[model samples]
Target: MKIKLKIWRQRDSRSKGEFKEYHLDDVSKDMSFLEMLDTLNIKLIKQGDLPVEFDHDCREGICGQCGVMINGIAHGPLKNTTTCQLHMRSFNDGDTIHVEPFKAAAFPIVRDLKVNRSAFDNIISSGGYVSVDTGQAPEANSIPVTFEEAESAFDAAACIGCGACVASCKNSSAALFTSAKISHLARLPQGDKETSTRVVNMVNQMEEEGFGYCTNTEACQVECPENISVLNIARMNYEYNKAKVLAKK
Candidate 1:
């Protein structure tokens, strides 16, 4: 297969960027998107041209490090598919593919398709953890978490913090990401101790990072690679409200 790629090329965050077109020929339909990029980069290197910069790690789609806008869709046209998991078969021969970074105020372009997603790390640093004491591992039966609660927590914990939710939102909100962090812990018994404080602090940090407010458009949930539900946002709001009300008492 062959495709024409119109990729965004930026020298750096300070440099002006624009689309540069390149033709990729004889691409295997079985090759993953990132693998196709590798092929392109190899050709660029042989020609003494600067290669397109993108992020990828654990290309099996577990790390969530591989993410970008393909034809204006986060991770490409496939639902619940990360860029690393996207294959060339999704596109036809002679297709003109538009590649760009995940656009958001908090995720400024660093170079080409690479954006600085450290804003998410900052939010997690604020309060996305448990403050448990250091000790030997506890027995599994000691906590007695219900099956339903464990499943719910697992679902929320599945979020990889890829920022797809932010990229997909018209307002560039991080509600789904922030809420998943809140919900994962809120459902677990060990997380109950800091649930109230965690929600408040995380939300505050999310806003401070320049992410827009959630308007319940549900676009974030739709584009999330993990399929994280918007329900987590509601859960976070409820927790925040409850925390605020209790603090008043």
Candidate 2:
């Protein structure tokens, strides 16, 4: 299969960027999207051209490092899948694939498909942790958490912080990401102590990062690779309100 790629090329964050077109021929349908790019980069290198720069730590979709807009959709056209898990067979021959980095003011382009997502790190640092004492590992049955609660917390915990939610939102909101982090802790017993302060601080940090507001568009939930729900946003709102009310007293 063959496809034309119109990829965004930026020398650096300070340099001006534009889309550059390249033709990829004889691409195998079974090849992962990143693998196809590897082939393209190899071709470019042999011709003494600079290779396309993208992030990919674990290509198995767990790391969430390999994310970008493919044909205008975050992590390609597929639902709940990252770029690394995307296969070339999803597209047809003669297709013109538009590849660009995850776009948002909070996530500025560092180079060709790579963006600085340190904003997420800052948000996490604000309060995404449990202040438990260091001790021997507790027995699994000691906590006695219900199965439903554990599963729900696991679902929220599945978020890999890829920033797809922000990329897919028209307003570039980080609500989904924030909600996932909030909900993951809110559901767990161990996370209850810091829940109130955690939600307040994290949401405040998210706003400080320059991400736009959530208008309930639901786009973030649809594009999230972890299938994180917008309900998490609602949960965060509730937590935030509760925290404010309690603090006022």
Candidate 3:
């Protein structure tokens, strides 16, 4: 099937970017979205044109590095799907797809479809972990967790930190991602000691990184490949407010 793509092109974060159109006459319906891009790159290279640059690792859709806005939607129109997992068949022949990097003040475009997502790393580093002394691994049964708690924590932990939430949000908020990280550890007993500090630091770091506030649009979970719940955001808020109040006391 033929496809028309208008992809964003930029040299670096400091440079201006614009959509460059290309036509593919031999796109296979079976080809994954990244595979379709590979075909386009192959064609461009053969024509002495520089290939479009996009980031992808673990095309199995676990990496979350392959996100791109398609037709104004983060990770395309599919719900709970990543760009790498989206197949060409989802698009019809002669469809004009607009592809661009995730847009946010915190996610500056590195080049083309690649954006510097280090802000996510910064948020994680700020307080996404439980600090403990180095020693032999603790026994698994030492701290027994109920099935419900374990399941809920796992659900929040499923977030791959794709920045799709930030991209899909009207305010370019990182609340969903931030909350997922916070909620994941908060639900576990091992993370209890640092929960208050973790929430405060991570939430502060999110604002420091320039991510906008979440307005409860719930767009983040819709585009999140993992379908991480917005309830995590509520948990984060509760934890954050409780921390601030306790700190004052």
Give the winner by lDDT.
3
After superposition on all CA atoms, what RMSD does each candidate show versus the true structure?
1.0, 1.0, 0.8
Off by over 4 Å in 2: none
- TM-scores for all candidates: the values are 0.98, 0.98, 0.98
Q: Each prediction's Cα lDDT score? A: 0.93, 0.94, 0.95
lDDT of 1 by residue, 1-249 (tens): 989999999998888899999999889999999999999999999999999999999998889898999999999999888999999999999999999999888999999999999999999999999998889998889888999999999899999989899999989999999999999999999997899989999999999999999999998877888999899999999999999999855
Judging by TM-score against the true structure, name the best candidate. Answer: 3
User: Candidate 2 or 3, higher lDDT?
Assistant: 3
Candidate 3 Cα outliers beyond 4 Å, as residue runs: none
> Least lDDT summed over 10 consecutive residues: which range in candidate 1?
240-249
> Distance from true position, residue 111, model 3, in Å?
0.5
